[model samples]
Target: MTREFTTPPASAEPLAAPPSRTNRGLLICGALAGPVFVVTVAAQALTRDGFDLRRHPISLLTLGTLGWIQMSAFIVAGLLTAAYAIGLRRVLHPGPAGSWTPPLMGVFGLGLIVGGAFRPDPALGFPPGTPKGNADPMSWHGIVHAVAPPLAFAALVLACLVIVRRAVMLRQLGWATYSAATGVVALVLVAWPGQDGLSMRLAVAVTLAFAWTTMLAFRLLPPAG
Candidate 1:
């Protein structure tokens, strides 16, 4: 009997390459940024002398003998946030939301770094020796620090709006609503004029915004190969 020529099974198409190690690392960095920042600040707030969560800001922690610790925390958190922004750029689907969100977040991170580098003026009776109710005249660094947080907050709010659009596209109504609400609440809290609770309100605002950011990083994690 004549041997029939047999064709080898068609080679399977090559699988797509897995995500890069760099990408994974960036995602991890992003994921850790919020928690690291929150935890560091929380610890300092709880233990540091002359810190009043109701009257003084977390930023004021940059003024005392142990100020270096808070400053370092700010710098480190900013770097991690920037790294996550890169990962967002890579992982998000192409669109207006995707195009703008990463840059906005990147700005937020840069602002944090800049704000840390330029410490705020002593105000609201911090550092144990300053006047209890009077804020010092704005120093150059204080002016810069004052500007940075608002700018960063603006960028973060814009990014949240952009993310709302994307969430709607994904048919996630809850996320979309939450995103928009987060922005609105942050704006309200930040803009509130009551000095009595300003510190606490601002802390809440920061927590809400960064917590949203951290959640986003978790959402953007690439699927395991």
Candidate 2:
């Protein structure tokens, strides 16, 4: 008898595995973390008394009776970002990005958590009734908090560059350029000096950083097919 051959039905193709499904959910959390944190802080800045975005650092929101809101936002966003990094580590298997990006992302998340745990000292006339001058002889907690943003921002910047490295290896020049610019601009903004509108610069720098994170999450979230 002649051999008979049969093809499997279209619907019989294997579906996405469980870990992949979990990763999608986690990536979505990463994508949303930046927006949630920024929106929460922005809304508070607009409404809270003596909180001028042009003058005050966003961290100052973590002061006064309403400070708890910002602290919660920080911790929650950080946890979500950490989850995002974990998902990325599992799925970004094609390049060196898989090696470096996740750990840097984790560092950024941890920095945020630490920053939330220790609010920065009041300065530049924020929280109403506080002195317009800087917080001299700063509290131990405030000093610790001061270290978080720069460290977090630096980690995030490195993460951006790491993606660039992988993109270049894959010959994705446009993606590489975009990633490089994002990292460089954020670093420059954060490192810029001068008091005039320094607060606004910091705000913009952070927004750029967070926006990059959100967009990168979306870009990498497509499932393997």
Candidate 3:
């Protein structure tokens, strides 16, 4: 006698539907946030008067006639980044990186929003007419602005560390190394001494962080298989 086994019904098997459009859109939004922020700030830096990229920080752009523009950019970037954090949560698996990255990114985004809302005081002779010095007496807003960046930077650094560990676990040695290096560079640049090239270093650090974030978002996309 011959025996045969019946195949399971299609419905009984796990459905393999394509990734939802909403998730795709959210991933794209997260990817675009960095470029949008960098380009907007670069444009403002080039056109705005008394805005010395070497001696002054981009946060100073949130002052004077065109202040609203940078302020809006900051808020927009932050919102996009926060949304991306949500997307990250949906896409990443329930592992070490997945557990840590989303929340850290959310904190980074929040720091951006808070920093933008509490605009930094005039310093390094920005806005064309301000005194050639730091924000004397340091208002509450200035203090908040000062604190926000370090907090955001710290979060991003931690996120990168998580990514590094995740990459190592996945056997992506190159990515692991890159993530570790990026974190180190960010930490060093943000802590650089003196005012010279501070803006450039900070810009580089922010760019590196966002570039890594965008790449990670792309990596987390569901495989086409």
Candidate 4:
């Protein structure tokens, strides 16, 4: 009897791997930008009175350099945010309840961050009241640097929560889910109203929450197999 040789059946498709730590790191890098930029803007706003570029001279230059670094960080962070969002879209697939939601929210958040970066404001102080008498756009510092940017940042956090909720309900609380939820809570705390001691407590809470999300993002990227 002649036996016909046949090709072996193809192996079943490989199972998907878990997210890798490296990817987690990248995602964290992207997500952290939101908090960092928010804090920077806050710092600038709080110190406006003391931060005069003309009188401080060298100090002014230093501050300017720091500002550039913060801006650069935001850009890098935006790219990373986009990248992770795309990854989630892949796993979650197309649907209102899938991965797309969180990431899209993230993109919007990034927009707020990036856009805020472009907003101009007065160097530090300029008449303790709101703008008046047709002020120069360049001199519109406080609003641009403080309020608008943080609002944008808050938008991202809100987006993250909406997306993450779906994931949590679905029992798929991965890095993306955690990051989104934690970010939202953090932003909210940061924005809560209070002065002195209360402000410090809120700030700490926000920072810690964001930091947790960041840590997960860096540690829990989906694995490639």
Best by TM-score: 2
Ordering by TM-score: 2, 1, 3, 4
What TM-score does candidate 3 reach? 0.88
Off by over 4 Å in 3: 1-18, 223-225
What RMSD does each model have against the real structure?
7.2, 5.4, 6.1, 9.4
Candidate 1 lDDT over residue span 1-225, tens digit each: 788894423321111223567766787887888888889889999999979798788899988899998898889989998998887777663643768888999999998898789998887778998877655577888899999989999999999999898887667778789889999999999998867788899899989998898877666665455
TM per candidate comes to 0.88, 0.88, 0.88, 0.51
Candidate 3 global Cα RMSD: 6.1
Residues 1-225 of candidate 3: C-alpha lDDT, one tens digit per residue: 999996644222111223566666666777887888889989988999878788778899898989998888888888888988887776664655777888999998888888779898887778787888887799999999899979988998999999888777767788789889989999999897986788889988988988887877676554332
Candidate 4 local lDDT, residue 38: 53
Which lDDT value does model 3 have at 118?
A: 89
Clashing pairs in 1: none
Model 2: lDDT equals 0.84
Q: Write the per-residue lDDT of candidate 4 for residues 1-225, one digit (tens) a residue.
A: 899994522321111234455544545554565466456645654565554323221112123434565455455555655665654444344444344455554654465455436644423333234342323544444344445445545655665566566545545557455667577566756666753354345445445544654553443344444
lDDT per model, in order? Answer: 0.82, 0.84, 0.80, 0.48
Task: Write model 2 residue lDDT over 1-225, tens digit each, in one string.
Answer: 899996644322122223366877888888999998999988998999889998898899999999999999889999999998887787674446887888899999998898899999889888899999889989999998999878988999999999898777767778789889999998988888878888888888888888989988877665554
lDDT of model 4 at position 169:
55
lDDT of 4: 0.48
